[model samples]
Target chain A: MIKANKIEKTYSKTAILTPVLNDITLSIQKGEYVAIMGTSGSGKSTLMYILGCLDKPTKGELELDGVDVYGMDDDALSALRNKKIGFVFQQFFLLERTTALDNVLLPLIYANKYPDDALQRGRKVLAQVGLEDRVEYLANELSGGQQQRVAIARALINDPDVIFADEPTGNLDSQSTAEILDILGHLHQEGRTIIIVTHDRTVANHAQRILELKDGRIAEIKNP
Target chain B: MTRTIRIARESVRMMGRNKFRVFIMMLGIAVGVASLTLMMCVSKGAYERVMDTVNRQGPDLLQIRPGTDIQTGLPSGSREVVSLIEEDVSAILQHVGNIRAAAPVKDRKEIEVIYEDKFTLTRIFGVIPVWAQIRDFGPREGEFISEEDISFAARMCLIGQTVKKNLFGDLEPIGRTIRINNVPFTIKGELQWKGISSAGRDRDNRIVIPITTYTRRLFRDMHLTQIVITVEDTKKLNKTIKDVRTVLRDQHKITSGEPDDFAMRTPQDLIDLAYGTSRSLINLLTGIAAVSLLVAGIVIMNVMLASIAARKSEIGIRRAVGARKNDILKQFLIEGLIVSLFGGLMGMFLGMGGSVILSSLDVTASKITPLAIAAAILTCGLIAVVFGIFPAKKAANQNPIDTLKV
Candidate 1:
């Protein structure tokens, strides 16, 4: 459901030429679980950002669901991000002062669909993530595992086709990390396409396909 | 929910969190509005007080005196000496459609009024009986001289409260005789107290007698010094004055180009002029107060900008959660509005209280009007919005990624 051809991203200034992503080409079909694995400074995050429509590529053609995302304006790109993709961050990035229910309802605010059932849907997602009793608790009051569960609940609130998990288990304990991996596997089995960006081999092993990044280019793609 | 309302509510909540800052902000605006209200009340009250005094004297009473030339600042042309005689007064009353009543007046020098041993120097006024009604002075005891007394030239007089106090010394002066300039005159009545006039003349320290008796016995044809006329209605006073002036000019036979021998005045004219001056003074004072309110609003804007900077991460989170740029702008604008609203309310109350206290202490205070309150609130709202724009724009323009980075 997503495609990129010769995507290039660069930063300006200074005599030395520096590129964050150079001539990267990739594509992923619907319901495919993919992992982009890279160490620091390997352009994995930049690629993830481009795919998420959060930033524009310096030079490229990007198509999502037959729409040229690269040609979309800022508002259209934001709308695409809201409707087509859900993001889960390493820090769980839930609003600190807001309750778990409200955190999950955030994406629905932009979607403007099923607004009357937003609270009910958020509650259902929280229950699915095993956070039924912590729906009203603030994000800061939750443990790393519980916070990540809330993030996952938020990702599922809009029932988006693709979910982006960037270093999702980076800050969690091993047991919490395993639980999050199991949830990702379940989501994948449910026919939701999932992309996880991480450096951990165990995390990458949960994906159906793994793409490794070296410097600013994709080194290899391995079918797990 | 509507974006502005949501932002206003959030702004209120934020203000609630920072109690001390809100308190300081309100203090500045309250002081400005309160002082402005107080000054307006005092000036209005003083103007009304003066106007009331003028009205009580007579509605169409004109004091034609020697005019001081603007170029030289001196009495012009030998004082003109165009006395208001009984014939002139009668002519105005007969010819002027709106002239309800008119009377001639003359006064004697300070004379000794004695009842047995109690005595005092008092002004003895030579006035026609109709003058009493025109001047708003009614008898507190018995009655003023009648037309019969005027025709018969009776030796009777109406004494003022001060004269009664000095001559009778707690005893009723009616039906008793008082010596005025060594002439024994029966005290027909005691005049009611009428307070002081705008010209600072005492209205309760004079004795009144029929003009016929004064002209025949006290001062003969001293050119009937003044004419006091009461118009039928206050609204038609200008027309009455014009008619009276025309009659006077016809009687005196002064040609169109010649300076006339009379002047006309109305209580409404004096009242309006005094009110205008008072209103201008109030506007000036209010303008100064509004400047202070603007300064206070600016202070609020500066403080809110600093707060926006400090809460950058909070803003980023809100924005990431679907808050539009307009929402952020509304939040800060609402904050300013909240501060100004509370401040304006408090100031209004403070102003009212101040006016009441001042009036109680015998200071003149203006009557409070709904228009004034509405104006005060509107001014405060405008101040909030005008000063709030800069801070709100600054907060709205912050980039979510950059703000969230730290």
Candidate 2:
């Protein structure tokens, strides 16, 4: 469901160009649970961002679910993201002042065909993540583990096919990290393709396949 | 729900979070709209006042008072020279065209009048019987000063309603004798109720006597105070005034270089004089309203720009959640529009309250009309749209990736 052909990303300053991702090529099938692992400067986050359709590569082609991603305009690109992809960040990235239910329902705002039962759908997702009682709690008022759970619910709101978890447990305690991995594992079992980016080996072992990056290139690929 | 209302609800929630910023925005627009409302109120009130004066004095009536230097257009005070007389009245009537009727009048205030044991200080007007026709007033009881009264110089008088109330109480005043300046004169008529004059004085507080009797018996002066003339063609007053001026100048033998020894006045002149100060005041308010709105618009722009800059994270998050650039634009624009609309209403109420107090104090007159309300709202809308664009555009153009990374 996801493919990249020779993807390259570079940052150009006044007179210097620094490469962030170089000659990246990969593919993942439907319902696949994959993990990209790297150290701080290994460009694993950059690769995940590219795969998540949040950024365009300077030189490459990307296809998500048979659609040429970069060829579309900004509006179409945004619509594609809302319909087919969900992102869970290290910071959780929930709107700070709003309730967990409001954050869970965020993706539906841009869904084009807003469901008549959008609130009910949001509540169902929150309940799926063991947050039925925390739905009315504000994001700032939630614990780190609970905030991550709310974000996971937000990702599931639009029922997207591809889920990207970039350092999803980076800021959480060990218990919260385990909770997030379990939720991602459940989503994968439900036929959603799951991609996790992390620097830790323990987290990578949870994925069915692991791709390790070094100096902006794929150095090793192994099945766990 | 419609897109506008949805965006407005979100915008309102955002604005409600910052109380002081919203207040500052509201204050500027409120002051500007308040001044705009006040300007309209005063102008409308002043116009109505001038028309009232014109209606009361009779549109076709003009007066020639014994004054030469009436540079201010007032027919009294130090400019009066007492050079006009009964003969000049005849000359102008016979010579000036468009003469409907003419009457000579001499008046004196603060005369002690006695009726039995009751006495009051009253004003006395010495006028011919034709004064009744010229002034469009006549006694409701008894008779006006007649031709015989003018020819014989009889000591006959007409008492006004105020005089009757003061001296006679419920007693009948017609045919009763009253002592004016120690001279006994029979009250031949009781005048009708004329209400209050435009000058804020009681109109029915004086007595009218024959001009012949007034000149010989009471005033002891051959010179008349004024000649009241009603023109046949109301539209031809200017030309008639010019003709009368020429006749007076020729009869008095005043050279072209010398100013005439009499002053002319018309209802139109009174209207013009009444508006002189009010027109300038209205213009000053217009300038204030314009400048206030301009400054307020600029302030709104600067505040909005600063707010958009500070709200970068919020903008990015909204964009990330599927909001289009145009959606952000609509949101902020709706926010400013709501603020301005409320500010305008607040200002309107404040202005109305202010006008009521000012009018009650007998200062400048003011009335809030429908046009004033419409103008206030329209101006607020225009200012909001004009000043709200840059900030909304900046907000819409914010990059979700860059902001989210921070």
Candidate 3:
């Protein structure tokens, strides 16, 4: 479902060039649940970003479902992300004043062809995440776990092929983390590819495969 | 179309994020539009009032006054000018092509007249019978001074409304005798109410007598203060004016290139003279409209910039969710437009309501025209597009990664 070949990422500030990711290569099959584990400054998040099509690699080939992901233009890449990738960040990034249902419907708004039953689909997704009762509650009014669920519902509204959760449980309580991980696991079981980024070994153990990164390169891969 | 509606809905949602920010943005446009509408209404009303005043003097009417060729200024406190005379009036009346009627006038300002041991100071004008029709002032009751009165130099007169009130005081004015400079003249008519003139002087505080009697018995001169002429076709007034000037110069024996000792005016010239005195007030109104709109534009732009600065992360979130740069641009631009449109509508009502209130209070003449309404509305849209661009650009050009970092 995904392939990366010799991926490299470098950030330049004036004359100084800082390498973040160096000669990284990896692949994950369809329906696989993978976790990228690293400590601070391990470049695990950078690798996830490149793989998720949110950031372009400095020098690399990335293929998702046989398409050259990095070869597309900015608008095409945005459309690709809208159609193929779902993201759950630690911040939630939901519009604070909007309702949970509205938050879930956001990505669908940017869809090239909006579905006529968009509102119905949005409600269904919110129901799937057990947020049906809180559909009318504003994002700020919801608890941390509830807000993350709303974010997940947003990520799932477009029915994307891959879900990227970057430290998704970092801001949540333990119970909320278990609930969110269970939802991610359920999404993977439903034949969607899930790539999770975390420094917690226990979180990595929940995945079918774990890729460990050290100093900008993949240090080890543990198969399920 | 659905996408457009979705984005428009998003823009509205963006506006509702901060009520204070939206209000701040609206204030300038509202105030600007209100002042602009008011200025236009005042200007339109002032113009209409000027035309009414000028039309009262008669659009086809022309005046040749004794002077050294100045176009404006009332020839008051006169009898010094000997250049314009009865013979010039006769020549112009006979020779001018479009002349419908003509009358010679001689006036003395602030003259005291007596009635039955009571006296009031008023202006005295001596004119022929045709002056009534040519100048549009005639008897409201009784008969005007006739040609027999002029030819026979009869001691006959017409008393104006103010004169009747002051000198006669509810008594029958017609057939009564009043003394001008101690000379007696029988009242032939009671003239209509003339009201105050554009110069703010009481127009009805004057009396009229036969020009023959004026020259023969009153001011004792063949010299005329002015000659009033009405034309058959007002559209040919310019050609008629040229003809009158030529006839007057010929009668006065003035050569070409030598300035005639007379001034001439049409209703247009009178309107210009009236507006000249009020030009400063008009300019001040215009300046208010301009400055307020400019301030409004600046305030709107700055407030939008500040609002964008506060909503930077919101823009980043929109971008991360797959909104293109153009989507961000269209969103913010529509937000500005919506706010400005609301403000403009509010101001339109305010300005029109203000004009009605002002007119009702007699503060100033004011008229509301559709053009003013259209201008106010279209200007709001234009302001949004003009002032909304830079801030929207700044929002669209922001780096999403940096904004979403935390």
Candidate 4:
């Protein structure tokens, strides 16, 4: 679960400031499926990054599982990202020359648990994502759909409590996008908390709740 | 099983993959080691050649000549008619603890040694029978004159190979009649050729006769020219020389304030001085070689820095995946160490081979001390680590996000 209150972020030394996220507060409980939807430059990705502990908010009270994430050091933030959160990128960001299994094992490198069991868990996650036969294949050799599944397997490698996906199917075709949506739906049914950042209405429609951002602030919250 | 080992293996594999670079690096080290080894071999060979020529005279052998005063630029009045009689030689033999043997020698120049119609002007040496053993003189034919020959003043002479060639030619000189200074004497033995001394004096061009015959019959009651003393052991040569000087001064009744009439020398002293000079020369050559090795280390460091720069993306990926700073540092350091280790091994093989080849070619064989090899390896290893630090630190300190951006 992630909680942020009055979050603000800015870049550069310009007095004419462009805020990526401004005075916005939100909290997501465990086992909830939520979507943040916005057009380009509307700050949805920035909000997702802050929520994932990848970037610190300029001014905010942010907590994850009752621990003050905003007050944590860089190593602690990395640890939180490793143990408590998983990220699935839109572009599938798989290491280009490495096998799908190796790409999936990347997240567990930071995990404190037994790495052998984590590798076994990664294989299981790949099987769950319908990439069991393609685990040994490289990212460039796999179809776009399969690469996204490998990224999903990588995000699930550490068995994180929450999965944050940013435009998870933006680069996929209709068939591949449908498969990714079905995988997300299955994960939500398994009682895993999920937050997706996207511009597509069809992708947001699958979520239990949707938050729309406009010009660095949350415009509206719609319960599905 | 450790991650560090895995990283080291990976680094070695990478070095192997870049064969040309590794070869260039190794070439640098090899050239340095080879030059060092060769220099040491040649210098040591020349030194030993000189030493062998000197030692062939005898162990504990010393040549005492009158010393010249440096400030006056003239021969010092240090040469005294020390008058080394047979009794003096006996006293040194009996009283000096470390003296193995002693003999008094008188060199008579421009002496005509004639046998049949053949005649030659040669240097004649009047010496005791122990002089043959002390000077390592071996007879090619017949036998050396005995002590009884010297006591009875028998006119028996040992002719050197050159003397036999000039005075007797193709005929055997043993028992042949020879005239020294027109005085009749029988040739008792023929000395084998001993080439030349390091001082460029021909050792094979002299005739030796009994000291009693030369002192009484040739140079009547003359002062002895030189006293040759051979010590029992080289380690105690200085002590023996000191004791001999003390006894001679006491016999001559020289007061404590005046300089003694005799001079003493030791073969070990000459050997030590020669070896010391040679060692310094070897060290100088090795020091120059070390500079080149240091330059090679710098080259390796530069190449490693380039490698780190080129592999920035790969490093970024590893760091992003939770590799600690020390892990990255270790990886780069291992790469440097692998390069240097390979270079060091190749250099050792090449250096030893070169030394063998040089020795086979009649050059003085090089002594490859374990200390030298250990020093070379340790220096290479240390250079690798020292030069690797900056590049490794650079690689380790890279920000993953900035690196991943491009």
Candidate 5:
């Protein structure tokens, strides 16, 4: 479950304020599959970031699973993200020169639980992403598609309640993109809330609901 | 606790990745610690060496020599005149309660010694029979001069290594006759091989004869060249010195406020003087070594700053994965500690090796103490922590969102 009330974000430079998000309010029930779709500068990624508790909003109330995340300190916010939300980035954001298994173990480092069993869980998650054979390969040794799979495995390692994937297919071939989309669809079916931020209409089609953002505000919500 | 280990393991892996850069940084610290250790080794070793020589002779021995004017401390102009006599020595030995033995000595430099065709010029010293035990110069072969030799003014003497080498030329000089200043004397014994003194003087280049023989047959004067006083108790040396001065002053007929015509030096005095000189030398060397550590610290800081700049993305990724600011700080700090600690250990070994080589070469009597090694390591660790803070703080405070944008 996630909620936002009139969320606003702005960047200030040399006494000039530029708003990135304005008066956007939304909510999603538990285990719902949703997509935030927009072109560049449409604030769709910003909204997703705020909802994932990675960045704070200038004006709004944000709640994740009945907890007021905005009121928590940096440590508490990080703990919430480690437990309740996982992120997949456009660049994959996997640590270079690190093994796939170790990358998958990243979230567990901050999860503050099951330290001894983290390796076993990381191996299981890598296997779930069909990367068990490639778990020992470094990020630099993997294909773009395989790297994205490793990032996905890392996201799944914590078993978070929600997943935020930003342009997950932006740098992939059509075949790899389809593979990633199928994984997302399967995860959604498993009753985990999914929010994908992307500009591709085809990518948005995999979700049950699509919220189109324009000019830093939510312009329309369509069920497909 | 396991998490902490994970973080340390990651840091070690990171350092491994940057092998060349890390080695250069560690080398800088290593040189600094090495210099620190070497300096301490040299000074401490030299100090121990001097004390060893002093203790070997006798800790309570005092040597008195005539100098200057009887009433003034100022030196009487050239062509020196001796004022101390056998009477002054006997007075100190009688009236000075703590004096165990006071042997009056008479010595002359450039005395020609000849054994058949072999000949050389050396110092000839005359002392009472008891002086042999007091100076720790008792003959290692044959025998020292006897009381019978002193009273009879017999032509018997003990030769040192240098004099033996020049006059005897590998021949057994004991029981052999040698001519000193054209006067024939039988060699009764040979002295031990005493090394050079701290003042850089040869210690085994003289021959000893009885004082009675020296006064009657050579100089024919009662005035003594020096007085070697051995105290009954070493702890009471200061009191003995004061009493000796009182007796000497009364014998020489000097009044209050008048400077004595003689100077006195004890084994303790030599030790204090040696320590004072070595301390200054050590301080100067230590100061120079400390500067090296400071320079290494600066170099480490620069390297760490560049590393922080290069790892921005890595920092962002770790932050995204739940690494707190303190975690990042600790990682870098631990990285610094690892480098410095290893460098310090390597430096200690290098320093110890260097000191051994130096001691062998006779450049310095150098040795490394355990405390010095521990201290050198601790200093390097502290230096790392001190210099690492700035870069570690910068790494910890970076904006993860901005870093990710890169």
Candidate 6:
């Protein structure tokens, strides 16, 4: 479960204040698959970032599983991000010049919990993303679609409770996009909560419910 | 993998990514450490050499030389002033408690000697029979001078290797006669070949004659230039020195607080002086080398800072995964230590090789010790930590959100 109360994010430039996200409240139940749809400058990406714990909200009271995340320090927040949440950026932010298996193993490395079967765990995650044969391929050597799958496998390495995907299929072909959606649907069927932020209508259609954002505010919610 | 091993592995991987830069940084540290190590070797080698030479003269040996201010007991002013007299030698032998043997020495340099058709310039030492026992020198063949030779002012002398080579060539010179200052003297024996003395001066290039013969036949002077004393017991050296000084002061009729115009030096004193001189020389050279090491440390810092800049994206990715700021800090610091340690090891080999080459050339003695190498490596590690912390801290403090955005 996730909750945000009156979240606000602002950027200051030369003594001028600019608000990227205005006061808004939202909550999502466990196992819910939701999509936030917005055009450029609509603050959907900003909301996703705050919810993913990548950045703190300027004014907010965010709670995850009844724990106040904003009240914790940077180290504790990083640990929470490691064990609970996974993120996939639009650009497939996998480490370049490294093998896909190593990319997936990144979270395990930082978590300092390399089980005796850590390598096997990494391999299994890559297999789930349909990259079992490309585990040893470097990011640069892989196709765009393959790289995105590798990034997804990395996000799933920690077995997070919630997956946050920001335009996961933005740079993929239609065939690759369908494959990614099928993987997401399978993950959602496993009872894991999923949230997707995208400007593409077809991508939003894959979610169980949709929320439309406009000008830094949530305008409408629909079950589609 | 263990946390430390993982961090070290990552650090090594980063260095491998920038091999040329790492190499340059290591070269800088190596040169600095090499020079420092070389300085230590040279100083140690020179000190040991001097100790060897001084020890040859025996440990409890003492020499009383003129114009060495009695106040400080050090050589002072002009040594041309011969203040010690023959009476001081006799008085010291009589009054000193730990007396072994005493000899009065008078020497003149560049003295011309002629033998048949050959002639050469050499030093002449006029000493009593006891001088042989006091200075650790005796006839290599035949015999040294005797009291009878001094009592009658006998025209008998002992020739050193150099003197014998010049005056007799291959012929035996034991009974040969040579003229010194137009006076005839027979060579009673040949002194041994003692290669070189302090300061690389020839040790076997002089002739020894009786003190009476020297004063009566050659340069007529009653004042002795030096009084060589050998103490019987090592523990009584100081007491013997004080007793000798007391006799000389009393013979000169000087009251308390007046300079004795003479100074006593033991072999240990010379050893200390030699060691101090070498230590200062080593310090000066090492100080110069340390400046370059400081520059190298700065260069390491600059390279690490540049690396942080170049790896911003990687840093952000790691942070997003779960790495804390402390992890980033530790990674960079370990990288610095690895670089410095490698450089230091190479530098140690470089310095050791240099010392070996230098020693072989016989320019100056050089010795490498294990302790010095360890010290140099430890210093390199310290330099790495000192210079590596700033950039590492900067990297650690970088905000993940900002870095990710970029």
Per-model DockQ against the true two-chain complex? 0.19, 0.34, 0.54, 0.17, 0.42, 0.53
Interface RMSD score of each model: 3.7, 2.2, 1.4, 3.9, 1.8, 1.6
Output the better candidate (4/6) by DockQ: 6
lDDT of 5 by residue, B74-141 (tens): 22322265778988877886788877788888888778988888889888899988898788788989
lDDT of 3 by residue, A1-224 (tens): 99999999998966888898999888889999999999978888888878877788999899998899878877887788889989888888889889998899888778898898988999999998999999999999999999999999999999999999988998999999999999998898899899999998988888999999988889657885
> What is residue B398's positional error in candidate 4, in angstroms?
4.0
Provide the TM-score for each candidate, comma-separated: 0.75, 0.82, 0.90, 0.68, 0.85, 0.85
Native contacts present in each candidate (fraction):
0.06, 0.21, 0.38, 0.06, 0.27, 0.51
User: Chain B in candidate 3 has what TM-score?
Assistant: 0.92
User: Which stretches of model 4 miss by more than 4 angstroms?
Assistant: A2-224, B13-59, B69-100, B107-124, B136-142, B159-187, B190-207, B212-226, B232-265, B272-281, B361-364
True lDDT of residue A199, candidate 1:
95
Best by TM-score: 3
Candidate 6 lDDT tens digits, A82-141:
889888878787777788988898888777566788899999999998888998998889
C-alpha lDDT (0 to 100) for residue B64 of candidate 2: 82
Give per-residue CA lDDT, model 2, range B207-238, as digits (tens): 99998898889878777778899999988988
Give the DockQ-based CAPRI class for model 1: incorrect
Each candidate: RMSD: 5.7, 4.3, 3.1, 6.9, 4.2, 4.2
Candidate 3 reaches a DockQ of 0.54
RMSD of 1: 5.7
Candidate 4 per-residue lDDT, tens place, A96-211, comes to: 66789978887555454436575678789999999888878978899998999998888887778889898989899999999999999999999999999999988999999999
Cα displacement (Å) at residue A132, model 3? 3.6
lDDT of 5 at A122: 86
lDDT of 1 by residue, B1-406 (tens): 5445545666776676677878877877777777666666666676666667565655566543223222221112342454556678778767878767777877754667777887788777787787777777878889988998899888899988877766777787799987777777898898998766454556678988887787776656566556677777768766766777788889888789887665544565556544554566566667877777777777777777877887786665455444566767787778878888898889878887877887787644466666557767887788778877888888877765546553
